[model samples]
Target: MDFRSLFTRKSKSSSIATQRLQLILTQDRFEVSEDSMKKLQIELTEVLAKYFEFTMNSVSMSIKREGNSYVLMADFPYSKTNKIR
Candidate 1:
């Protein structure tokens, strides 16, 4: 395999493979399944939407093991209707 050939390729299969491996490792380390993540996202979105018009597409929730504790992140834009002057 020549090093120059890698630069000529336009495919991102290498990057995809790396991402998949990291996802699996992260899940294993955190002891969380992909399904749980999806469910949590859906439920949280629903709960937030009830009170305010949330931008679901822009929301991101991730759970990862950090040190000895688990970190959970929920990021989304708040409804503009509730903005104060």
Candidate 2:
């Protein structure tokens, strides 16, 4: 019996399942979901459009770990070159 192969398969599946569970729990705590995040990005683009110009994928946001806590961070590729006035 190849115990190594059995152990490898078990661990791989376990790791993937664990990661998925963590993602679900984290998203729950944050009160957000993948669909909501996409909607938020689109809405933000529309609202910010009146003041700034940015192409598709120019803005980004995500929840990430920083030290011991998770944070929702957003980025907007900013430029005053094409500011709407």
Candidate 3:
């Protein structure tokens, strides 16, 4: 058994677990529920669909903590041909 391989594998696994924990903690800290996030995404998609021809997958939304306030961030991929306006 190679000792170095064990350390390397454990480090990679630990890093991923740590990142996931941090994400969960941040989400909890902001008190943002998964259902609410999904609802927001659906509503935003419906509204944007009126003016754009893009797949729901093209829109991405996330909540970011900025100082004492939470910021809602959204990104939409737009193409000239996809514009309904």
Candidate 4:
């Protein structure tokens, strides 16, 4: 009977679904064979770490279906300290 509860449940469900869909779509676009994605993830993480000290789990880099083509989207947290080096 509470609208707030309904909204919260819907929001959580939608977020989970979106994340799941995005992962699947990304895997599909990259044509990442089972072992390949694992290799790619590791290599990318190492490369990124060479530049900054950040949590690998906190960053996401992937190729996704956008319109008729696939697009690579990477998200990283920025901090003012990065400007120094």
The clash count for each model shown is 0, 0, 0, 0
Query: For candidate 3, lDDT tens digit of each residue in 1-85?
Result: 9878876745577778988776576567657886776777778988999888878857766567789987867788888889795
Of models 2 and 4, which has the larger lDDT? 2
lDDT of each: 0.71, 0.74, 0.75, 0.72
| Residue pairs in collision within model 2 | none
Candidate with best lDDT: 3
The better-scoring model by lDDT among 1 and 3 is 3
Tens digits of per-residue lDDT, candidate 2, 16-66, equal 898887667656756887788678888888888777786755777756778
Which window of 10 residues has the lowest lDDT sum in candidate 2?
Answer: 2-11
- Residue by residue across 1-37, what tens digits does model 4's lDDT show? 9767866745577778999888887788777874777
Task: Write down the RMSD of candidate 3 (Cα, Å).
Answer: 6.9
C-alpha RMSD between model 4 and the true structure: 4.4
Residue 83 C-alpha lDDT in model 1 = 46
How do the predictions measure up, each by TM-score?
0.51, 0.51, 0.58, 0.63
Stretches > 4 Å off in candidate 4: 1-11, 82-85
> Local error of candidate 2 at 55, Å?
2.1
